[model samples]
Target: MSDGKTIILNRIREALRENPAPRPHASHTSSDQEETPRDHTPREWLPKVGERLDEQIDLFARQSEGLKTEFHRCGTMEDARAILSVLVAEGAWKKIATHTTPDTSALLEKNRAEILKTDTGYQIDDLESCDAGITGCECLVAQTGAILVSAPSAGGRALSVLPPHHIIIARTSQMVPDLTAALELAKERYGNKFPSFLSFITGPSRTGDIERILVLGAHGPKRLTVLLLED
Candidate 1:
């Protein structure tokens, strides 16, 4: 064998002879000890979030700013309605798509734009034509500034993605401190009957692939506005 190949083989043999390094959070299955499941939780590696609600909201706001998401904290439903109205006026939206939810129905009751409810069903072309999509969310993750939306919470998958602008109307009570907490909440809330679709939307769709120039709405909504109402 060549000197280089022999040296490589000798190194491999030496490595095999030495004891392997223990895997992080791995469970040992020796004869004397009982075998336990490996720990998969990554709480230690995640960013720390405050226990207080205000601190969490603040973190979420800061993260959202970095992600270029428009976030508004409304003290009342009326405030949210006013914000929605302003958005409609600014965008000159002639039509909006949404699902049937108490909050959505209340906010869009007197909207100037035509409403397309996707509760039962909707066409892709019609949904795509709408200027904006309005929907409720499952929860807001403060640590990552992510909004969790499921098919049941928001409208069908297309409603949020097809429109040019995506607006989320959620209550402050739905906010969670981190992704782990959000997952736990989902498990506790849904149990075995979880929604068919679950997604984490960090911000408006964007890409910096072409010449390292950031562009929004590359694959999804160009604008993401969160209207957070106090419960």
Candidate 2:
């Protein structure tokens, strides 16, 4: 398993050995040239310097695995549907609570066959009782392998909090480089008017408070599966 740093170094080495590419010449600037230090509004506190969409996606998936979560890559919405079907079957997750979101509404219309026993009008009680809950995410933070979710997008936090198994479907476009970037995007999208509730899920809920032994799903879902679409 190659990490991003390893991959980047390898590419640099290969380019140096094979192409011997020349460095770009620096541009001349006026003596009085000045640049704005930062945006008027406070920017997100990003630890990582730059945005690398492809690399970020790879990192997100790898990091998710490190957190004991399953990550699947899909080429399209239909591909996502196929993967979802296989996961549902494998887990034997009946009585699923499917929330209504623009993203999921389209998925359900196109691939309802993959879903089993979904409660369209999902109730808080249904979320607690359902075998699994299927929903969309607000964003995925690659740096920390956390899923950024909000009440508006998830139709309430109960679907993600109460289900024994939580399934999330998101497109590549929703991938954020880091927590800072995710926050910036969310703020821009919502301004001072943010979602009523916001939550970050690193993986299935667990706690090590019991004798310092880490236990998975002690407080939340036992399984967390993410269907990442690569459109």
Best by lDDT: 1
| Top TM-score prediction, candidate number | 1
C-alpha lDDT of candidate 2 relative to the true structure = 0.76
Question: Per-residue lDDT for 1-231 in model 1, tens only?
Answer: 579989999999999897987755534445644443433256755899999999999999999999999999999888988999999998899999999999999889789899898999998888989999999999999999999999999987889889999999999899999999989988998999998889999999999999999999898999999999898
CA lDDT of 99 in candidate 2? Answer: 72
Question: Residue 203: error of model 2 in Å?
Answer: 0.9
lDDT of each: 0.91, 0.76
Q: Mark the regions of model 1 whose C-alpha exceeds 4 Å error after superposition.
A: 1-40
Could you estimate the TM-score for every candidate?
Answer: 0.83, 0.72
Candidate 2 per-residue lDDT, tens place, 1-231, comes to: 999999999998887886766754435443543533342233343345236788888888778889998888877777777776776677676567777776677656644333433334554564576777778888998887899988777757687878788889898899987777788888998999998899989999898998999899997998898988875
- Ten-residue stretch with the least lDDT total in model 2: 35-44
Please give the RMSD to the true structure for each candidate, in Å. 8.6, 16.4
In angstroms, how far off is 187's CA in candidate 2? 0.9
